[model samples]
Target: MSATDLSASPSAPARSRTVVASLRLLRSELRIIAGRRRNQAGILVLASVPVLIAVALKFSQPREGRGPDFISSATSNGIFVSLTALSIEIALFLPLAVAALAGDTIAGEANIGTLRYLLTVPVDRTRLLAVKFVSLVLGACFGVLVVAVTGVIVGGALFGLGPTTLLSGSQIGLADALARLALAVLYLSAGLAGLAAIGLFISTLTEQPIGAMIAITVVSTAMWILDGIPQLEWLQPWLLVHYWTAFSDAFRDPIFYEQMRQGLLVALGYVVVFVSLAWARFTQKDITS
Candidate 1:
């Protein structure tokens, strides 16, 4: 039945069954993502960044007082480990991870001859797209947490956790520092969610998962390059990546929330707009595969 028929169905039992099936499909999607070899490898690579950072810090003197304030602070406080690692990864590693997962969502299924089968199984395009987008978001969250959590553990083991120094030169206790790290993780995850939405829309345009993945990465990288150009200062705020590094503001003494809040709003806007575009395109596209 068509999605309209799905909505117009009068039987409560049918609607209830659809909900149950959708939930099961969601679970299946998550399991598939978790088991995918590329995703597993991506997680491992992401987790290693923090460990590497901690180890590097342990062996050498953090440049005394130069480069990413967090670097210099690493020797004095373990909390900097996660923050520094995230700073290093947010520009590429994190976005690429989200791109890999989001780009594979619909395109991957279609490439494997499963898209038509899914539709035949009574899974409407709308619900399927929702499941895919949600899986991407959850994937982004998992990827971000892997980096942050791994960093915290390794950093703590190497440097010992204690009060964290803020960018403003003020200090906060370990409890508060942990909270800020949580906020940064959430912020970066939200930013990646925006990219996932963009990738989801791109995934609908092609049957080749690799093409979609490359397209997503290109789009992400282009934005990064554009946001860095001094001439594009006028357009920087409009770019989604504009606020990615703004997560560091959380480390400021007073905890600057404005940029983070704006970042969230931008991310939310991207999610809504791109997901709507994906739904529109996927609902209308022919699923010959």
Candidate 2:
């Protein structure tokens, strides 16, 4: 017997309908993001930034010590510069990206009044929120991956492949360079995950997307300020922003595995707490708006 017969016999259509609805919603969400010209343009622009920096550095550096013996100093410099740029960019701009994308993910629907339409469908609120959160988080990850790969490719093409050289002393071989870069990217993503969760949490608090965006940015800025205060240095361990710069520790001579582990732990805690807060708040949210 087919699903039709099963539905006609005695089973509630709940499970089947939910599967169909989720697939449809996923398509709609992907279409909405993929079809937006502004989003596409923004991605292209961001992808270009790292490539442009690599090109500029390739041509601008004055000839110095015979680069790195085992590896090209130019490549090392490019990787360092690209990674450093990404770190700074994430610290300064990614909060805005997270706030802008995640903050608007659901609130935008409510603003335009389509949220009620979605609710009109038989879809459960819990499933709907879960799918939306997954889509948004995946999109954020895609953006970060774009930045990372572009940096590495551009650096390799322009400067030539080389060993991983650290500012903290010691040099990494080819295999280690690849491994370190992978770890660096993973570490960076963890930091961004916390930001995304914070943004998502704020999104659940308000119907206005702008309000949510601004609120999260404010939270990021406030955390950064507190993390920097001399008297509040003790609070650094509790601040997510404090770990945003810890990817550099991956380049240390002995590789500060302890610090990396602690950073990951802090990031994981932030993601869990913030996402749980968002879900808890959203579950009780009134659809009246």
TM-score of each: 0.93, 0.81
lDDT of 1 by residue, 128-161 (tens): 9999998899999999999988988999988889
lDDT digits (tens) for residues 16-132 of candidate 2: 876787888888887787787866876786678677767766677555555422123444554654574466567656566667777667787788878888877755777877777
Error of 2 at 288 (Å): 2.4
The CA lDDT of each predicted structure is 0.90, 0.74
List of clashing residue pairs for candidate 1: none
Determine which window of 10 residues in candidate 2 has minimal summed lDDT.
66-75
Residue 171 Cα positional deviation in candidate 2, in Å, after optimal superposition: 3.6
Instruction: Evaluate residue 159 in candidate 1 and report its C-alpha lDDT on the 0 to 100 scale.
Output: 88
Model 2 lDDT vs. the true structure?
0.74
Best by lDDT: 1
Off by over 4 Å in 1: 1-18
